[model samples]
Structure formats: structure tokens, C-alpha cells
Target: MIPFHFTGARVLRPGGLIETPVGITEGRIVDAPCGRAVDASGFLLLPGIVDPHGDGFERHLAPRRGAMLDMGDGLAMLAVELAANGITTAMLAQFWSWEGGMRGPDFARAMLEAHAAVAPLQAVDLRVQLRVESHLLDDFDAIAACVERFGVGYVVFNDHLPHRQLSEGRKPPRLTGQALKSGRSPEAHLALMQALHQRSAEVGPAVAALVARLPGVRFGSHDDDSAERRAFWRALGAGISEFPETLEAAQAAVAAGEPVIMGAPNVVRGASHAGKVSAQALIGQGLCAALASDYHYPAPRQGALKLAETMGLEAAWALVSDGPARVLGMTDRGRIEAGLRADLLLLDPETGRVGATVAGGRLAYLGPEMASRFFG
Candidate 1:
């Protein structure tokens, strides 16, 4: 990678945007100029986005429901999208659920192995977040083995089963669709849900025990709906709250000093598609600590820009960059400061599009508008 002396852009710093020349050499930001001189008078130099949670890579991994045989190509394509969207560091959320096909335990293990193999070759720093289904007690040992073997540091507990319908012996909505997706018959899927629901008493203790086993792993709760649910996960040593479904849960997590992660799409869409608490509302109340891309890679950048309309660019941008880096306990690349990793983006102020992206002091992406500036 060629070292760079970036001049003429309004650089975003911890204080605010400033007309300062930034330098990058050997993958770290520096004070003095290095190798090449680049004129960037028309762009906004910002830190490369650090996305905490996103599953948009799933489509690239299996675009047509098992159409992809090799994971490397899909991951390579995913990296291009990440860089194009100005994402430098991303946590790819993979599922260890009862759902078969792409989301099964087998698929999770394969994905983890493939990610480990492909990460070294990509410029974007890609990490995996294993989403464990709480009711899958039989797979606890396998999950632990995978975590240990793969060095997975982040884990989130999820319970997507419709316990209410299953407990009442009623058919859950979308039962047929889900069953077909999982390659299971509707009757078998319903029976499995019922079995898992019947063992509800065992799940809490089992999850707590699993959490205890993974001492070094960062734990979080997914889709927390109430204060009690948040408290339950917190009591189990989960420190992060991912997408609290209601205001009460968000407030409870904030009051408990846990970082609350909201979907960036919620802020962009102005509301939750699932009829849950609005992310913008939570951000206004100071309850949200970070905004995750969730299922959409473009939402993080778009969401922050939207919030910048009122919260100021610095604060809104922090929700996607510094805030998420803090949530992940990564102190290396979120801020554009000396001695930190040189992960950055050059955005066109007029159109709000990324003109170029630099990750680890290497040019990861270059848009058409900025191509001539770098080459000509």
C-alpha cells in the first residue's frame, strides 16, 4: 500500500470538522506527509464506518437458496460491497438456529471456517457474530467448540420461536413458509417448536450456563422487548442490548449502563417495519449507543446522514463509527487521530456519495468521480 498525504478536505476529528491535511503511512495515521500527494479539496474526509452488526452478506453467501457452493466467491463479492459503502470494519452476523438450510448449525460452522480463510485476503476487516438460538440446548457443546476453535469473540442470544402459539397448541403464523425454508414438513416444524417451548424452564438456566462457559466472549441479547427481558439478559452477564423492541427495554438497558444498539434502517425509515420502538425516538432520548447496519449495508451511512440533519454530523456519525467501535471494545480504527489505524472515507459533500475509501492505509474503493483525482 502506498502512503498518502491527503490535503484540502474537511477532516472530521474528535472535536469537529476541520480544514486539516491528514497523513497515513504503514496502516496508521501520521502527522507528517508520507509518499503520495493527493488533492482532496472537494470532499469530506471522515473515518471509515465501523458496523457492529449486519447480515446483508447472507444474500451474497447464498443468493438463491443454496445456489452458492463455494463461500469464498460470495465473501469476496461481499467485501467489495462493504468497501463501496465505506465500511471498514464489519461484524457479519451468522445464525446458529434450529432453522435448517443456510441458518443451521452446520452452515454456521462452514461460514465461520470460510470467513477465517477469506478474511486475510480482503482489505475490509470482517468478523463474525454468532447468533445462538436459546432453545437449541443440544447444540450448546457444538457452539462452544466452534467459538473456541474459530476464536469468535461476540455472541448474541436469540429466541425466535413463537412460544405463545406453540404453548397454546395453535399453529404459528408463517409456519408453512418457515418449514419449507428449513426443508422440514409443517408438522415436523410445529412439533419441534412445541418441544422447544415445552422445555422453556430449562432454557434460561442453560443459556446462563453457556454464557458462563464462554468467559472471554462478549455476550448480548437480541430483540429484547421489555425491561424484564433486558434485565434477564443483563443478569446473565450480557452487556450489550441489540435492537430493543420497545422503549422500556431501551431505557432499561441505558439505565443499567449497557450499550444499546438500534437498527440503522429504523432511523432511515422513520419507524420500525415490525411496529416496534423507533430508533430515531431512542436516539433523541439519548438511549441509543450505536446504530448497526442490521440487514442493510447502506443504512449506516444513510442513517447517519439523515440524523445529521438535526443532531449535527459529529454526533450522528459517532453512532455509526466511534460508538460501535467502543461497543466492540476496539480502540484502533474508529477515530481519525495520530497513532490510530488509517481507515477512512472521502465523501462528496454535494451528493453525499463516497468518493474513495481507505482501509488499513490501502485504497479499498475508488468511485468514478475521484478516479481522475487519484490517477490524472
Candidate 2:
């Protein structure tokens, strides 16, 4: 049993939050006091940010104009960066495309092994979001095995139709921005994308069946453009709309009980880098249930601040903590309650940067000097 108190902090309790000290015993929040003894003073005690999707792309994992980093190095870099950002849980959104060719395969294989090796040594909670690109349907066999072996919690349905998204009359470009990041030559990338498109049209029922067959995994559909389009696949057990491109698709997701997952960068920046609906509108309507960091590492934490700043503190915190927790089926940890796990974060209420992080009854992140006292 571990007992500690956080005084003068905003303790976000089940019913509501109060400026008080929280008591922890056996990793459970057993009590809270009106006038605290231990001085929390100015710390913001909030739930650890639950990131549904975001990858190591920023670490040159998917280098846009520069060289790619070693997979291990990328993961290591991301671990430290995210914890500091106040993200307690992260889902590394790995994009695997058959048209992606050799690099995709190499990165996927290496990252899986790297995940296994790094957890014991790392301080943060990192999870995997396997973004299965539909164009790469041919690699279904290899992918099924990977999901079974890895604890990839989220599986996304991504079909990037190159010829369709490009200029209507022109031949598909040899390499798009995404392909360049993957280090494929334009000609090779175009060829791979085209082949994958053909393979998708072939539309092997086997691939769809395999997707449904994979257990212990939740299904997410990416870049949903319309409600009709979104529903067609949700009927097939696809429960997540990763980046709904339009209001109708987002509404469609809500009506069907599927959560809408948008990028935090989109919400904070007021627009999508890709041409998509505004995240701000989605959040205003309560249409958005979760916010993933996406390609930006600090967006999740910053997004929370932006939300609180724009909408109000109580509401903004709800989006980052309670909203995402409910969507992910993580009821216990998201809201501060008596019986929930002690996965929590301490940040400055004014600024959103995470100052300390706790997970599974252990203080995972602390200041450089006190680190010894907690981890000692």
C-alpha cells in the first residue's frame, strides 16, 4: 500500500473538481481533504492524457524531406518526448501500405520487436495503433500474424486511392508527400500505389473476413468522406472513424455509436493540413469524442490547453481526459475516482506542459533531482 497526498491541487473528482489534497492508498484514491497539509500549491493534477493515435513520424520515422532515423532510435526519442508532454498513454499509429513497398515492411517488422525490448526500460505508457493501408491488401497474411503477436490495440482501415485524390485528368504522381517520407522513388511509389489499388478492387472477401476475425483489436476507418460511405463500413464492424473528412461523415459516425477521432493539431491549429473539416466545429458540437496527437507530438497536451483556453477549463479537461477515456473503454483511469488506477499527471494549470506523470501505482516521471526519491 502506498499513501501520499497532493495539497492545493485541482483534484478532478468523479462528481466535480475541488482545490484540495488527494489521498492514495494501495494505488486507490481513498480520500481527499478540504484544507490540505502537503502543499500542491500551483500544480495541476489531471488525468494522464489518453492519446488514441499518433506515430513516431516526427522522429524521422516518416521523414518528409530528411533522412529516416533507425526504428529503435525513433521509438526511444518518442518515449521521452511524449511523457514530458503529459501524455500518459500513446498509440503509435504505424502506417503499413502494400504500395509502400520494402520500407513499410522493414519499419513494421523492426518496430514490433523494438516495442517489446523498450517497455521495461522506458518510463511512459506506449501502445500500438496498426494503421493497415487497404491498398496493401496482398500483405494481409503477414499483417494478421503481426497483430496476433503484438498487442496492437487499434487497427485502422485506410484505403488511399491515389488516382482518385490526384488531379482528375492527370496520371497519378510517381510519389506523393507520404511516399517521399517512406523513402520510395516517385516512379516506384506510383507503381506500388497503383498495384495496391488494383488489389483493393479485386476486393478479396478474404481480407475483409480476416479483418473481422482479428480479435482483441478495435477497427478504425480512416479518411471517411461521407455518412453513406462511413455507414457502409461501420456495418462491417468498423467502429472508429480516424479522420472523418466531412461533417456528414462525422455525424454518421456519431449516429452509429462509433467515436470520431480527429487530430489534436487540427483542433489547435484551426484547420487540417490535409483538406478536411474543422476540428474546432466538431468539438463545439460534442461530435468529437477523442483527440489523438496525430503527427504532432505536443498537440495532445497543447490541444487540451487550447480547448480549456477557448471553451473553459472544466470543459477542456473533459475532452482530454474523460472524453478519450470513455471512447477507449478505459473508464477507471480517466476520471479521478475512489477505485480507479493511480495513473495521473501533474502539470501547471496555466500552461499545459506535464511536470510529473504516474502510472500503475508508480511515479513514472518526476523532476531531475526528486527522481531519485520517487524511483529510489
Candidate 3:
């Protein structure tokens, strides 16, 4: 069946706009200005978004303070929201750790099984990208097993603790309401962090060794704070920098030919909530390569529109969609093209509210309930 054909929308394709029609078939773009039309006048059509970072594991596997929801529920809700925002592909950041609670081995297992059951049914492209915390090295074997089961696509080395330690404990600190609710004093928390820091150091070598063999999986580094840090990660075979915390780190990644991602929230908020480097600053310097929604699901789309409004249309749109897709090796979906993936987002050009989102040429998200009505 002809999947879909949207007309009258400003088509974002290679080299620019297409005042023509789009032919979507078999979940990929079959041709351009090639067929029938689905009314989309006054809308700006764009490629489906690509999001590489977001710790949804925490939200789904561990929803509240000491409360863990069904793995399926979290994934379900996330799928809707993601598709709504034109995110045709989402990399679920699976946090694996030997630590108690959220990132525990048991939780990881549940996640792996859950993904196995649902990823295939997703409306948008869904893949698992293990977010490995070196401190969680004790669970490395189990993690490897899970990756094999999930056909994992990517892995990101996250040493938040180590970076904080080097920066004198200044990074976005973690907070488990359970811990605070348990009446764990601030001193106790500090002690826990220090212990976690030590644990991270203890298993670094083993994690390094395991990561070396997963060549099929692309590797990334998280929260890079400096040029040296970027170089160090690149040396470790992690060529993508996820949310580099400083402009210098982003520049270093660019210099090394590594794609650097920034949080979409950073772009919308104009800076990091954690007081780190601003996404705007990085974008202005041409140091940004990708955009991830981070904690908020709706941020990516809104951030893209905001970035476009501020940084000119072409550049802003690239940060969230084409740019990230390019870095992730998704040559098929970033922009509208013949023989590419038919992932498109139709937006009300004025407010940028997503009017319709089609994945694989199927309209997956639309109108009121289809999108986060708050922004877009």
C-alpha cells in the first residue's frame, strides 16, 4: 500500500524546500514530488527527529520515590510522546549499574525483557543504548548478556561521578526521593556519593575491556567538561559526546570528528539547569552535533522551533533532526528524500504545534491528544 503522501507542506529535503509532493511507501520515502497528496497547507514538514539521550529508565523502571512501575507502561507512554514530537527514532538510554535500586541488575533484566517484548511493536524506531556507569561494573557480565538479547545499537560511557569528583563534586547531583524520605541526612548522602565514586573507580578497567569488544555497537561519552576529557573518551573508542558540559568539550569533539549532543531542554531554557554550559553557546560556536530531549519528552520539538526562531530556520532544525540523524548513521530518515525513511512531521508554521507525525509513512501522532498540548 502507498503509506502516505503529504502535499502543501513546506517539505524539508536535501538542499532545501520542496514545493512539491512526497511519496511514502513501506516506511520509507519512495519518491519526491512523485504522487498523491494529503492536505498539509501552511505546515512546515520536517524529517522525523532523532533523540540519542534521555534516561527514561529512571522514569519508567523507577517512577516515583521507591515506586517502580511496570516496564511496559513506561515504554508505552514514552512511545506516544516521542512520536508526537516527530521523534521517529528514539534511543532508550538504559542505565545499568550494580548499585541498589534503579540501575540494579534485576531492574536492568526487567528492562531488557520488556524491550524485547515491545520494541518491535513501536510506532517509531526504538533501540536500546546502554548507558554504562563504570561504578556499575560489577554487573558488566549481566549487561553484556542483556545487550545480546536486545540487539543493542549503541553504548555511552557515563562517568558522572568521576567528572563530579574531578570538578570538586559539581555536576547535576542525583536525587532519589526514597533516600531523602528515609531521612538520610545530607552528610549520609555525601558519604554515599563518595562510596559510589570509589566503586566507579574500582571497576573502570573491566568495563573498559568489555566495551572494547562491542565494536558493532557505537560508543559515546557523557557530560564531557573539557577538551582533554573529550580526547580521553575518543581514545576509549567513544566517538560521540553525549551532552558535553562545556563549549570546550564540544569543540574538542568536533576537532576529533566526534559528534556532540546537547540537551534540547538546554536550548529552550537558554542554558543548563545544572549550571553547566549553555546549549545556545555551543550551537553558536558550531560545536553541537545532535539534540536529545534529556529529561523532558516535549523539549526536543519545542527546542527546535525555538532554536529556529532564534538561530535561523535551517540551523535550528538541523540540531534536533538532521544533525542527530547524521551522527547516528541514520542516512535514511533525517531529511525528506527519495528512497529514504518516510518519517515526517507536519507543523503549524506559526506556533509550530505538531499537526501530524508520520513514521514509516503511517500517521502516528496528530492533533490534541496526539501531542503535548502544552507547547507543541
For this target, which candidate reaches the highest TM-score against the unseen true structure? 1
Residue-wise C-alpha lDDT for candidate 1, range 264-299, written one tens digit per residue: 999999999999999999999999999999999999
The TM-scores, one per candidate, come to: 0.98, 0.86, 0.86
Worst 10 residues of 3 by lDDT: 367-376
Put down candidate 3 lDDT per residue, 209-262, tens digits, no spaces. Answer: 777756687888888889998887776678899898887888888987788899
Over all chains combined, what TM-score does candidate 1 have?
A: 0.98
Q: What does the lDDT come to for candidate 1?
A: 0.92
For residues 61-177, write the lDDT of model 2, one tens digit per residue.
545434654656666777777777777777777767654432376677777887778755665677777877765666778888888888677788777666574424346654576
List residue ranges in candidate 1 displaced over 4 A. Answer: none
lDDT of each: 0.92, 0.72, 0.75
The residue-level lDDT of candidate 3 at 17 comes to 68
Distance from true position, residue 80, model 1, in Å?
Answer: 0.6
Residue pairs that clash (backbone atoms under 3 angstroms), model 3: 135-200
